[model samples]
Target: MESLIDKDRIQVKFSAENQFAAIEMAAKPLWEQGYVDEGFLAAVMERERNFPTGLPTRVGVALPHTEAKYVIKEGISILTLDKPVLFAGMGNPKEKVLVEILFLLAIKNPAKQLGVLQTIITIIQNEMVLKKIKGAKDPKTIYNLINQFI
Candidate 1:
């Protein structure tokens, strides 16, 4: 399995206007690389609206995704915003979260979702990993930090 921090899918932006804008902007590189389909951006936005993936922690993170078919490739793409973006809460409907790190995953295998989720969970559970990801200054640093998991 390859790490998600591929050159084509990484974006380093200071801020995003809103959640939809953030997702669309981050998904562009993947779309351009043919890792995602034409409808993937819309689908991911819709899925996020319907079923939020926001996880509240010391350092809040969001795992935005849709079905596997939307992805033409199997990898993870990471986007870190200097300012946080708002995403609806996963366990709570009324609550909203400020997500600093967005793990935009493109997995073609539905069966791998569980393992991917597990890996994400484990990584986030560690305060150090979360801190490292949050403190990473560049895409390559973030990529190197996450590659340790694989």
Candidate 2:
């Protein structure tokens, strides 16, 4: 997974005014690089709208993803915001979360999503890693930090 991800796929301190903008920013990398098809962004956004992906972790994060049928390859587009953005909470649609990080998941295999999300959940629970990621000075550093776990 480490070798598969390019540093450019990881962004740092990006300014996304809202969750949709943030979703677009994160999903762009995968489709632009041919990791997924053009419909991926729309699919992810639709899924997000119907069933939110926000999680109130140690450092808030949103995991926006769609069905495997929409994916051509596997990739995770990561974005860290300049300021926290609002997203409806995953557990409760009526609730909101201030998200600083977004992981746009493109998994070609449906079964893999669970395992990948488990790893993501682990990363979310680890405050030390999230803090390091939030404070990262460059995209390469963020890439390295995520590579350590996934």
lDDT of 1 at 50: 90
Task: Compose the digit string of candidate 2's lDDT tens values, residues 1-150.
Answer: 554467868988999979999999998888788888888889999999999999998788999999888888788888999899999999799989999998888888767778888888888899999999988979988888878887
State how far residue 96 of model 1 sits from its true place (Å): 1.3
Kindly give the number of clashing pairs for every candidate. 1, 0
lDDT of the structure predicted as candidate 1: 0.80
CA RMSD (A), model 1:
1.5
Model 1, range 64-106, lDDT digits (tens) per residue? 9999878888767777788888888898856888888788888
* CA lDDT of each prediction against the hidden true structure: 0.80, 0.87
Off by over 4 Å in 1: none
Report the Cα lDDT for residue 19, model 1: 82
